[model samples]
Target: MMYIRTNQLLKAVILLLFAVFLFLLHETGEIARFINPQYVHLSQIASILFLFLFFIQVPRMFTNSEDDLCGCGLWGCSHGEEGRFAMKHVISYGLISLPLMIGFLFPFKDFGAAEALKRGVQYQVSQREARDEASLEKNVQELLEQSALVLHRDNFVSSLRALMAYPTRFVGKPILLEGFIIEDCQDEKVTVITRFLVTHCVADSHAAGFILEHEDSLGGREEQWLQVMGVLDVKQHGGVLLPVIRVIEWEEIEPPANPYVYP
Candidate 1:
């Protein structure tokens, strides 16, 4: 690839793309070693080389006269003497290329330190949340192992009451919840999301509810509720219980006339 003969136009394009790709990949953690700034010394040097090549091609590319182009692939196709060269093209090139050249020549260390700090803080918070959520899950597991009973109709009702009081706290719990299909499962299962309610409004609301894997699509029609009496296993992340239901049994029943939870 190094010896692959290429025109200046293609070379400039490839270099520009190289810079953009490097930046984007760095953002996504896809180019970790390259963006490390410490270990990626050779990569940084390669970037500088590409940038230099791109700039050296630019002023040549903007030149109207083929004579001004020392080489065959100096620039894109151009209009001859009949047209005057536009200042916009050259001015725009200067505006873009100057900062890039300067930044490459003198990269900021303080700015990098701040960026690293921000990323470190974000990572710490993420790890902390994961730990807390793990601890809570262990507690729930211990509770279940001892004599803690699975959720039933009465507890589900109580959970609902609790859900309404502290919507954020319990709304996302994996309660062994059973409700009538009331309506067709818009997406999956014979289950309607009895808990996917939003507080501010439906727009801001998330349909955060346990999915009851009822196979029959039309088994429970409107107004036909179901009996969901099982254990409500709580798997929390960032203090939010991700719904993971352990279904005991489900039976058909009449749906409550007023079904939507008033958030």
Candidate 2:
């Protein structure tokens, strides 16, 4: 009869499954939802490492009792006894397998208004002093030169920061932006156009948006995606000055495939 090490087999299977899960994430382009694209090459390297470990484990699964014995020559080998059931082993394996199960079972979901609310929407730009005043002035100058500003994922963070930092400079300038709508609890009449900014991963994502004001009622439109063309203005909120968008022409739009803005 051929003796097979069950624990070695389990380890090999798990390592291979992890590689497959990561590969699938990249294949389907869903990896962007989890981590920054700059780190994607590192993730690919990890998947390769797991695959290599899986191959190394294959030989151990068919090892005989003598092969399992260590050079220390103890009374009984501590290595090949993983077939025995133990609470600690079960818990360890279960914990290790939990992320794999989740990756395979659940569908990827983009961060939404509920998540933004929980994280607390950042209506104003950070008050940190600019490290490069010359560079900052140059970027702001380029934006000011534009007749109309259009916000896209690539330039969303920098452009929005410039506008928010100098709201007085951008007042009455035509701007086009797209994001999911979120209603403010304190003011039912006003709604926020929100986008999540991801630094490294979804865990570190933070909501950034502008308060929207319209002549027509904006209520009952919460969580819907919209393309808004409006004029930029400033408003006082919570005793702080923040940028506001006075809607001129707006239309309902489908949510973008890549929703998060990367900084």
Q: Could you give candidate 1's per-residue lDDT for residues 5-67 as a string of tens digits?
A: 223444466568667655544555443322333334566566667677778776444444445
Which segments of candidate 2 are over 4 A away from where they belong? 65-80, 128-132, 186-189
RMSD of candidate 2 to the truth, in angstroms, is 3.0
Minimum summed lDDT over a 10-residue window in model 2 is located at 69-78
TM-score of 1: 0.26
lDDT of each: 0.41, 0.83
Instruction: Tell me the lDDT of candidate 1.
Output: 0.41
Against the hidden reference, what TM-scores do the models get?
Answer: 0.26, 0.91
lDDT of 2 by residue, 78-144 (tens): 4635557578777988999999998899887889989988888887666562555565677789999
* Highest lDDT scorer: 2
